[model samples]
Target chain A: MSKYLLNKFLYTVDRDPELVERYREDPRGTVAWWEAERANQLLNCHTGEASTWLAFDDPEREALVAHDYVKLFELGAHPFLTLTLFIAAFERDHAEPLGFQKEYALRLQHFSLPYPDIAT
Target chain B: MAELAAVIASTHHPFYYRASTARGEDRPPFADEWVRKITAFRETLTRANPDVLVMVGSDHFHQLWLDNMPQFLIGKAPVYDANWYNEEREFGLPRMVLKGQEDLSGYLLREGLDAGFDLAFSNELRIDHSITCPIITLRPEADLPIVPVYTNIFAPPLPQPKRFVQLGRTIRELIESWPSDQRVAVIGTGHLSLELGGPRQFGPHGPDPEFDQRAVEWIANGDLEGCLSEVTLDSLHAPGNATHGFMDFMLMMGVAGEGAKADYVDTLDLFHTMEAYFTWYPSGGPGLSEERACEPRSEGKGESA
Candidate 1:
């Protein structure tokens, strides 16, 4: 329903690993923060049951969401987000930089949105 | 039955953003050139105006995985929430709801199986750049629906060339049998040579110039057997891992029929990628006669016409 909120939450979690650790350390508090900030407004879209995550203990939450941030981004092989690939793009060395990232920025320009500020 | 309108094969690399890297009198990186090419390609698609687009692309280990990935999978959802598949929110793709062809997808599953294609079906299927990149760049009207076909060309145990060709033929047959007057277009997304993060990372790795040129020759001439037989897994992966793109091209060739003629072919020599774009047309009316011409003209009868 709230796709924007879902994208923000996934982007936030994907953009930073520390936030994921925090989410693992305190599922309730972390989720509360996302909720307070409206980042998890569409929490159910990301997680099947929002309350399930709320009820999850720290270890359980960690196992569910933070165990392997990068690998977990995928349902099976396809990542939940394209940013996952964009981030992985830099792992390789090429004469050109951010090949996919640059393309993504151009695609964003079509939407009239500003380019992402996250440093790769 | 839906009439096939056009067939397109493209290098689906993320090159839309690297305009600043152009070199020479055109600046450091060749940005303007690509912009013009992409713009022209997008315009070409708009002009074609197919009612539905059947997108054939390789999976990026995103939706389908090695553990349970099928050789070919079809998306059957009437409307899909594509957000589950896209991570890059900045691409400005309309991730909320991607339209699908439920009835046509159903026909494809049932008929595709009958045609010897054990197509995996998913209603909750998600897609990655392989499908999105072309759609967003082409900027098709909002009304156009798409049928997503995911092929396991990236991972090992890829389908043999013959099998991929057969799948394409089966799709063609299914589309022809459908009674809808829908104008259908088939878009295959991938590259000739691209080795991502492989041994050639710092330099030229996966995309092979020779391979790219040869492939263009085969497709341009509509040499079906040449395409199917000449380019193998080794030849594709020789330059780098990115050459798996040929698989999509194979599927496109199949659907286009053996008699399809390459109307236009362009290559972009970007870093780590030798991307190419090709638009094909059936020599005349779905290339049925062209396909017949390719046959021994008398294979079963024992005489060459």
Candidate 2:
């Protein structure tokens, strides 16, 4: 309903209850993210009934919209826009980043279009 | 009646954002008015109620690169969000998808064979902006389901123009073959005419309108394949990354099965080595629903005559 810059923008951090607890404890690893203005805005935006998450591909090309993991990214101030492939970060892989947000992986159904040299 | 709704392509060399257009030229990130327009369009696409999205675009480091990547891949997910980049943090600002993915791998294999594409299938992949931007532009909130195909526009050993065209037809085949009676959209994401790091090469600006117009004409005419056939990969790159992986669009056209509607919205001179155009293949003229319940498009037999 509201307009975001290019795509739906949301930040997230680790979703596992324990990992989030750890992130909250370690002030250095994620201090900048904690201070991001939009992060607080997103937290205020969520009403539980509706919330968007980070959309990414599975190991095999499936898509996932695990909102909680997205919450992790949003919590950390890293907003990325991607398509069918899994979303990655400059500093980390999709799995290891954000405290292993594995449960959030979304696997969507779609055919693979063939071209060339595009080894996975 | 399988019809192509839209085409989404990917390209390297940032053109849209002047601050980030040049290599190592880190300017502040932007989420300007133009960005808002694109986001609005995504809402319109979702209102159409399409089932399955056929995404044809390139890969940066998300899928494949010199170090690691895939030639061709597909996505299977019930739900996924499209993302926008935050240069400040170098990470994805996640969005959410309500529902998607209908397990169409078999259909892809079938049509891919008939169309002469050597596909590299995968059940696991994380798509990048090349594939995602187009999808988000059409369906911003990630409410729509999709079937994505990757193109090696970024890496070496990419598919030729004609080959890409055949890939499009295969999409037609897969969509038509499916029996769920779902309406579908095809997104080809790429620039009409891009010069990559355009601000650096041509100054901080967009490509020459003449060049972009010619390229746009080709796309609208469904003659992108012919356009590519006329030029060598080197010349294509002169305009920018738009041309780098442009052949991928030809493949998208094949899937859309001909006829790019005349409506090209908001042709902007966003930056040098890059320009953006929004157009679609009308599933069935005005007043007709987006559903493609007819027969698969008649294959052109070859990418082009």
Candidate 3:
């Protein structure tokens, strides 16, 4: 499922102010760019030593492009990463405190126990 | 030999920094009560008069990533840079730099590994909110040298609940055996039935109040047998998706010893989660006189926020 790659994308982008804005402004473009350029680059290694086999599957790419956290959750992408990055990307849209978080919870109320496995 | 001054456990809420510091209309209604409870909680550590702090917390995908995740790690750096860009963006936590107790870190790593816990060591670790939140609440002056111990409570394939307790026990033993006269306080932070990034996120209370009630009792009473019998890696999910963080508290329970009731206990029911604080005086609370040590334990409970 390459859930690890999905998390790596969220983790890398969420830590950088420029990337957060870029992903927020253009999810499709950012997802495409990240999958092509950043996916195979080992985080702690030099660019020249980047691995060649890491790539997101079609469903994962579409979910990121769509900014669909619910789909990300269903796909077993780590929920904490998705939530933190999404909050950073979108919490500004709502004026009230915790408004976006409450809405985020309501959207996923369908999920019951044994929620999707997040193990990599 | 070093004295095990105090063993403390708490819930590390990142929102507290922003909530407590917000001014005028920006401040939430719960700020005043939270501050009061934190001030009292801070006293428990201060009264112990510790020379060093052993901070126990979990990293939230900040420095440790999935590719090379360690189950348990100790920071051996001479200094650690605290907080992160995301924490600043979300929680308004100020960036801090704290001195490290490298001698204690070295002792724990060497002894912990020899004691059968394969602990990873970091020479240049940047701690996240899990470690920093307690510092903000308990030791805002940030004067004491610290040894940061990071546990893997976030990632899956985690160590079993018993292992965390065992590690805690080993840490306590190692500290007491260290050939130094310094008094050390071990502080750890974890959650009570927390659910993040799921259907139950941001609820009025923790995702499971019944579980929180029982968990608090287990900790306050130091009922490790009761805690371990009921808690397992798989079972933690029922309380909340993120409830596994409670294992850190179990580790603290190990440090406190079996059947060792806490000397200080407090709780505050804030939105989304419960805030719990606990402290134990292994050597009868260091700075106090003999009569004061025998006095009744102090307890505080806050009204619902």
Candidate 4:
């Protein structure tokens, strides 16, 4: 469930600038806030192993986590997250039925979420 | 003065392990061939026996994050700690200590910054598969000292192609100026056409072999301008933003210069990967003059054995 927790954490961080700012200000407290909101999910993801939960004491550590988030979610470094780029970055496809665009649209359909009407 | 021994560019995709360890159904026709070819390339590297190997590669968001991403970085540790971060664990590369050349790191930092490149210095930065993949395959011993030059191609605002070329030129200048008699080799890890993480990265649209082949031929033939002109920022970013590895090739070309000759070239049809080795000699050959070599060179030319 580290995957799910990571996805949810990244999903929220990708959308909420305020949360990102909060994470920037205090990473441990931000994790505490996230735990307060989704403690059960985090707990489920936690196995009897070294915690993958974001824990960084210094700005450099926070920046390290932030960098991974930007690469995976914001920068389209991961696959499913690449579609999120269409809405987030507004980068258009060069050809017909844009790949990221189409996948994002279909994913919204699958989740029964409203189409974002992203203007690429 | 330090001599430019070799400039080898190869594909460093993490899936290389999967391809290498495929048992039955997953094995592509080119997998064994890829292994054979890389083995041969490593043989050549061993013979070259470079005292210090300078690796030019890009970050994978594993080491550098978004909050404080530097456009360029140089590792300053005497021994690099091979800490496999996320996604790199699959490679199972040892968490061992590898030698690093701090002198070259400091020189590159000072000169790179003075040349208008925003260079970041790190003594404890961990390397990702973009580098380790090639090191594990081509230079398996991991005994040689290395200086890693990293650029941010995994995200947007990737340093321009011309800028990478200039960065290569700067490396060449530094190597030429070094008072030590180090026989230096440069490995520009990563290459042509890959579409990982995006939907189009797999299945029917996964890899564009046609593009890979064409790009490989251009590089092997030392067509630097052709590569620079055609492999534009837009072209590389096509097919799921995967071809960013092309920056490594451009940087290699810049370091090798016009005079270097392409000695060996291999293009894997399956992974859409291309591998080429170029050598620059002290004497005359087809490569650029010392003056011309400094003028934004490509990385695919050098002496032929």
Candidate 5:
């Protein structure tokens, strides 16, 4: 019964603010922010360590981490161990639908969060 | 005599390299020693040169991840190319032969042991780095026939080490059971050490050599738990080991069989990372077996050679 810490971390942060601020750069859109943030956390988790996880980075893979993060949080499993199980479930069409991206976007626009200081 | 011959686990580090180079983005802390080790193996691979290289790596979420990410998968397509970067960005990556071995692919699923590896084999998905780099490495500008083996390492909640190894053994069983006469090679590619993003603590040149050395030693000896044990935050310099994705190497190491074989050897140190570490194994041998005890092994559909 091994559990993924990411799943717990996301579920915990999905509703709580205290945990979200640890990695969040902005407080606005905290909920939605956590989605992408969680992906970043998972993707870049191996920063200074000699890890093979981030051996190669792809912009698109960021999407996979985000999508998979939310999908796992929804299932409420500890991420690391069951993470692949959840991924397998999604691939097999045996899991829940992933539609959180838009909702997260709406939340971001609602609060103008992440301080998107984009140069337009 | 072996049936399927050999199984491989490989990925497209160069495809990722192409993307990273373009954006001028840097994935830091990938110990140079890791790559150094792999590059050395290239020569041996060239010498041993198997008939078909069984590659195990991850996809771009195109064929699977976006829609679904399987813990493990196999490809049955006859051929595939990078339609996105090649056609769109004009990268000029050659289309690779995914091998029209439907019977083998089908047998891997229908007959291979269900040692807990999930399947997501495909015939339509265009290729990605996870499927492309080996072409360049194996032949270096030559098109070599490859049987694609896809796994979801980048995506969330990847399988635990134990299960992933289980999947590797499944790969061994399936290959050992194959009846093909061609000699086979197993390849696993990805980073041995990696750090992501910018303005971060550890960069490409970051030291932290202690962790890197340990990983090299563990992988060389097929000490998975030893590798994982040392794979902690202090070594990673972050909560997660960016190179954790390289676990595929360990999985492939398991399939390659035995310990400390001189397959892929590292030479140059890229920003303190081993550019490569490669190894070669004798052909015609069967995969791992539970001789003395009933060790949890990778199962397959085999009727003996």
Candidate 6:
């Protein structure tokens, strides 16, 4: 359960307009590409100094590819990152203001107090 | 010594820029009232006539990340670029640049460390909506130089809630002891029982209005003992997932000092979350007249204790 890796994916992708559109259009392809090439690249370091030990596990990979925010929440991914990226990708699809956000909440009504531990 | 001009705290709602500036048909029904409340809130700072602002807010993973996050940091640069690509994309916030008071920042860092807080310093920081939103609402001119203080309310392994209050107190003490004549206002922003990216998010009101009411009372009255007694790191979760941001408000309460009732108080019960505004004048302030100083606090929706 590499919550840090999952958060890094969400954080990196959300900041980049191209990555946001790419992941929105092709989740599976983006996840596969990100895992293969970008996963181990240290954010503040040169590519040669990338850490080799960072990689998402199977469930985390599947959750990302599937665009499953609920599964990501269950997996202890940072909800803020997931929600931000999802909104960037999908908010345009909803006509009303905060329509997508309301829907996101409804979908996760099963979660109660003490939601998944998000500590990295 | 610099005069502690005014201590102000508010909820930094990013959407206010777009909502308050929206035009005919595009404007939401709530924008007019929000603007009115904000206009009144702006007057509180304007009356103080502060030269430099010590702005306190938490970084929302914009520049500070979990990989090597600082629990508390002070931006010590000569200039600060405000707003970000994501903030612009999400909140329709305009980009801004504000001058930095590096001397005050240095004073705080050197003195704050000696006071026992391992404060971090950033030379170049592009501040996000947490700092900029107040600029838009209060000092729309964005003319005053500022010192930006970032707190780790977003990330885990966060400092305890009391630590925020302690830092606020230290900030107030340090600002008073600085050997400058410039009037300084310490402004901070935080949330009240907010839930983002969770099951209770984006509701008609904040995730927990009951908690918001109690939290507002604790702040407006400067009841740090009451606030500290009940609010723990573990206990905050019951109010809302994002309620940790309320610690910034607690931090402001510490700056205001114990039993210091706010001279000005107002709240707007907006959609999704409640907006609160508070201001305390330490020395009766400069521009505030005797009659104006005695005016009743505006009870927008919530009452101040």
Per-residue CA lDDT of model 1 for B1-305, tens digit only, reads 57777788887754363343445764534577677677766754665667898888876655564336688999999875553323443332445457898888888999888877888989877777788767755753446788999888765567787777778878887887888999787888876765443333324333466776777666655678888767776666575555666777888878877856665566666665665666654423444344434422111212221
TM-score of chain A of 5: 0.22
Per-residue lDDT of B34-89 in model 5, one digit per residue for the tens?
A: 34333433445655556676777766434453224567777776665543432122
Candidate 4 interface RMSD, angstroms, 1 decimal:
10.3
B1-305: candidate 2 lDDT, tens digit per residue: 54444443333223233332323434333435556555544544554456667666665444343324456665555554443333212333334343446466556755665666667665545566665556545654555566666776654555566666766776766676665666767776755554321122233454445666665556655665457566565566555433556666556556544555333333434434444444454554343343332211112211221
**What are the DockQ scores of the candidates, in order?**
0.05, 0.02, 0.93, 0.10, 0.03, 0.88
Sequence-dependent TM-score of model 1: 0.66
- A1-120 per-residue lDDT for model 1 (tens digits): 222233344445544556645755665677557655543233325544243122323333342344332222222222233345334323243345555444433333332111121111
TM-score of chain B of each: 0.83, 0.73, 0.95, 0.84, 0.71, 0.97
Chain A TM-score for each of the predictions: 0.33, 0.19, 0.98, 0.35, 0.22, 0.97
Candidate 3 lDDT at B199 equals 94
Interface RMSD of each: 14.3, 16.6, 0.5, 10.3, 15.8, 0.7
Return whichever of 3 and 4 wins on TM-score: 3
Q: After superposition, how far is residue B59 of candidate 3 from its true place, in Å?
A: 0.8
lDDT of 6 by residue, A10-100 (tens): 9999999999999999999999999989988888887788778988889999999999999999998988899999999999999998999
Instruction: Indicate whether candidate 1 or candidate 2 has the larger lDDT.
Output: 1
User: Please, what's the RMSD in Å of model 4?
Assistant: 10.9
Candidate 3 runs further than 4 Å off: B286-305
| Candidate 2 segments whose C-alpha is farther than 4 A from its true place | A1-120, B1-36, B67-69, B77-92, B95-100, B195-202, B257-261, B285-305
**Candidate 4 vs candidate 6: which has greater DockQ?**
6
Query: lDDT, candidate 1, residue B210?
Result: 71
The regions of model 5 sitting more than 4 angstroms off are: A1-120, B1-12, B15-40, B86-100, B198-202, B206-208, B228-241, B258-260, B283-305
Task: Provide the TM-score for each candidate, comma-separated.
Answer: 0.66, 0.56, 0.97, 0.68, 0.56, 0.98
* Best model number under TM-score: 6
Estimate every model's Cα lDDT from 0 to 1. Answer: 0.60, 0.45, 0.92, 0.60, 0.46, 0.92
lDDT of 2 by residue, A72-104 (tens): 222221122222111232124333422222223
